[model samples]
Target: MHNDDLSRFFSENMAVDGELSFQQWEGKVLDFAQRVSRGNCKGLALVSSGGTSVPLEMNAVRFVTNFSTGSRGAGLVEDLVVREWACILLHSESAQLPFRRVMDNMDTERFFTELMAPEKSSAVASIVGTYSKYKTRLLLVPYRTVVDYLYLLRLITVAVCHRAECLRTMPMVLLAAAAVSDYFIPRTLLSEHKISSNDGMTVHFSCVPKVLNVLSDIWHTADCDVSRLFVTFKLETHDEMLETKALKNLTLYNCDLVVANKLQEYKERVVMYWRDTPGSPTVLQRPPNGSIESLIVDCILRRIECDATGGGRS
Candidate 1:
C-alpha cells in the first residue's frame, strides 16, 4: 500500500491495540511531517512592505521609505516556506530581497544596454521568464510607497477576514511582522522641486494606521480567542531593562507572545514574561546562534497545535 494510505490505516486502527504498535510510530511520524509541512507551506498569505519611515519636517512632512533591506523579513519568509506555508510576498520598493534571479549572461553593461532596446521591456521579459520556471504559487503585490502598502493591507485584511467568516473549517493566522512606516509626506510635496531653507518648513504629520490594531480589534469583535491569532513584537535595546518594557508592551497589546530581542547579544536571548491566563513566559535555554528563525517557527507551530487541541500541553 502507499505510504500515506498505510499511515491513514494505522491511524484508524490505533485504538485496537491495547499495547503500543507500529500505528503509534506512524502517528509520531505524521506529527513530525505536519510540523515540517507547516514550516514549508506555499499557502495563501499577505506580507506587508518592510522598512522604516523617517520624519522629514518636525511634525509635518516625512519620507515614505523602502529601507532596512528586508533581510530579516526575507529570512522569515524562507522559514515559512520550510513549514509548507504558501505566501503572497508583498514587496515594497527598494526591498533588499531580489524576488527574481538574474540571467546567466546578465551584467551591468547588458542591463544598461537592454534599457535602451526598442524591443519588449527587459523588466517584463525577466518577470515572464522567472514566473514560467519557479512554480511560485504566489500573488505578488508590489508597492512603491507607504500609502500603497496600507491600501493593500486593508484589502487583504477584508478578504482574509471574509474568508474566515464564510468558511467555518480551517483557521486563518496573521503574522504582523512588517516594519510599517509611521508617517507620510503630504501629496503636494510629491511634485515639489526645491524649498528655500530661509523659510522654515512645517508639515502637518498624521499617524499611519496600525495594521495589527485593526486586526486585533476586528477579530476581538468577532469573538475569536486571543490564542487563535499569534502576534510577535521586536524590541531592540539593552538587556538591563528590555524584558520589563517588552512584557509591559505585550500586556498592553495582548499578543499571544512577544519575542524580546537584544541586538548586542548573539544566540542567547532573554524572553520577557507571558500571559497570566493560560501559562507563564517560557524561558528558552541557550539556543544556537543562527537559529532564531527556526525557534520562532517552532514556537508558533507548537502554540497552534496546542490551541487547536483545546489548549492541551503537548
Candidate 2:
C-alpha cells in the first residue's frame, strides 16, 4: 500500500474514544527506547503479544476478541532477557506477563495469599528477584482494543527505530506475536451506548488494515542504519494449508521469518520459513520440560548474531 492509502486506512478505521491516552503512551515508549539505546545490550527486540478486542459500542459493553493468553509471547520475553537483549513488550491488558508466569499453576487463593504472606515462598521471591534484576531491560506496554494496539504499535516501532538510528550499530528485531483481530467495527459505526437486547441484532465489520505491508518501509525510512529483522506468526487450523499460508504471508508481507503452527500442535512445534530459504524451512520442537518459545527465541537470536557478523540470513 502507498503512504496515502495507509494514512487513509488509519484515519477511517483507527478512530477511538478520547480515553485511550495515546500521547502519554507514546512518551513512555520513547523514554524506554532512549534508555535501552543508551545502555549496553546485545540488541533491541520489540515483542508484541496477546489479542486485540473489537468494541461493539463506544461504551464497550460488548466486543469481539481473539484467543490468546499471551503465554508464548511472555515466555519469549523471559528467554530474550536471559540472552541480554533489551525488550519492549506490547501486550494486552489482561494477558499473561513475563516472570509472572512462574505462578501460572498456583491456585488463585494461594497466589494472593503468598503475596501477602509475612515470609514469601521461594517461588515468589525468585520471581521478584528476577524482575528486579531486569527491570531496566524490559518495558511493558499494555493495550486493550485493536485501535489502541495498532496505534501503540506504530508509535513504539517509530520510537525504537529512531533510537536505533542514534546508536547506529545496534541490531533490531520486530517480533509480532500478537493474535490481532482481523475484523472490527469502526468507531463511527459503533453504537454510542450499550446495545439493548430487547430485539435481535445484526452487526457488520470491516477488515483490519495490514500493518505488515508498511512496517519494513517504516524501518528503512526512519533514518535507521542497522541490521533489522521482521518476524511474524501464522496460526492455522488446517494442517495441510499451514505451510502454504505461512509462505504466502512470508512473501506478501516481506517478512524475514514466518513462524507457522497448527492450532492443535502450536504448543508442541512450529515451522519457520525464512526469507532466505523459504523452501528449506526449519522446524522447532518443544522439549519435554521446556517451552517452544525458548527454542524460537534461540533461533531468532542466532539469526541476529549471524547478520551482525556480516553473515547471510540464517
Candidate 3:
C-alpha cells in the first residue's frame, strides 16, 4: 500500500489553478512513463464484493445470498488467468468463500487438522481429491463492509491510474458487479434489546454513500484517466418493465454499459437491455429460455469487449 503521506504530497503539489499537478512528480513520472513506453506495463484485474448483512426480524425467515457467492466473479477470474491476464480478486465476507465441490461434504475442523499435520493425511488427501484443479493468478484484497470496499477501491484506483498513465497504457477497466447494500442502520438493533409487544420500534433509515457513483466522479475529475471501457450491473425484480428502470439507473450512474437483470429472471434470463443512450436500446443478446451461467458470462464479456473498443460512453 502507498503511504498516506504520498497522498498529501500529491495534494500539495496540485496546480495553482486547481488542475492536476502534472509536473509535481516530473522526474519520477517521466521515468515511469519511459518504462511503460518500453512495453513493461502489467495488466490487472480487480474483483471486489460489497458488504451484506441482512437485518433480522423476530420469527422472520432469513435470506441467503444476501451478499454474494462470489461464484460468477470467481469463475470469470479463473478464465482471465487462463488467458494470462494478471488480476486481483477482492472479497468482502469469508463465510461465503467460493469453495470447491469436494469440500461440500467434508468436516471442516478435521480437514484443517490434516492440512496442518507434518505429513499429508487421508483427510487432506480426500479434500484435495474432491477439489477442482485451477490456477489462481490474482492478488486477494478482502473487505468486510461497504466502507472497507470504498477505501480499497479508492486506493487501488489511484495506483492503477498512475501505473496506466506512466506506462502510456490504456486506462484500466473497472467492473461494478457487487450487490452493495443501499443503506446501513446507524445504530445496531441488538443494542436496543427486546421490544415491548405493545410498543413497536420504528427505526429511522438513512441512505448509504453510493460507492459506484463516487468512483465515477473521481475518475472523471482526476487528471489520470481510466480504461476506454467501463461496465456496471443493475439488478431489479420487475421482469415486465425491468429494461426501462435499469436504463434510467445506468444513465444516472454515467456508466458506459449497464448489465441489468431481474431477480425473477436469474434462473432463465432471456431478456436484457443494452443502452448507450437512455432513449435508444438494443436487445444485444438473449440467453436461451432457461437457466445458464455461461450465457450471463458471455453477455457480460461481450459488452466488456465492446467498451474496450471505445464505442460507448463519452
Best by lDDT: 2
Q: How far is candidate 2 from the true structure (C-alpha RMSD, Å)?
A: 2.0
- lDDT (Cα, tens digit) per residue for candidate 3, span 186-210: 3333233444458765655445555
The 10-residue segment of model 1 with minimum total lDDT is 13-22
TM-score of each: 0.59, 0.93, 0.59
| lDDT-superior candidate, 1 or 2 | 2
Q: How high is the lDDT of residue 71 in model 3?
A: 52
Query: What are the per-residue Cα lDDT tens digits for candidate 2 across 1-314?
Result: 66567657667765444335675766776776678778888888889999999999988899899869898799889988878888899999978999987777589999898878999898789888988888799989898988788777877777767643454577888899999999988778999899999999998999887888777667656564567888999999997799888989888888989999998898999999998899999999999999999999889888877776778775
Q: Please provide, for model 1 over 155-255, each residue's C-alpha lDDT reduced to its tens digit, 9 standing for 90 to 100.
A: 45554444333322334455555667766654433334444568876666555544555555543444344344545546466774676666765666666
Give the Å error, residue 180, model 2.
1.1
lDDT for residue 45 in candidate 3, whole number 0-100? 53
The deviation in Å at residue 294 for candidate 3 is 4.4
Q: Local distance difference test, per candidate?
A: 0.50, 0.83, 0.49
* Model 1 spans with C-alpha error above 4 angstroms: 1-46, 52-66, 98-137, 164-168, 186-204, 209-211, 220-227, 265-279, 283-290, 311-314
Model 2: worst 10 consecutive residues (lDDT sum): 14-23
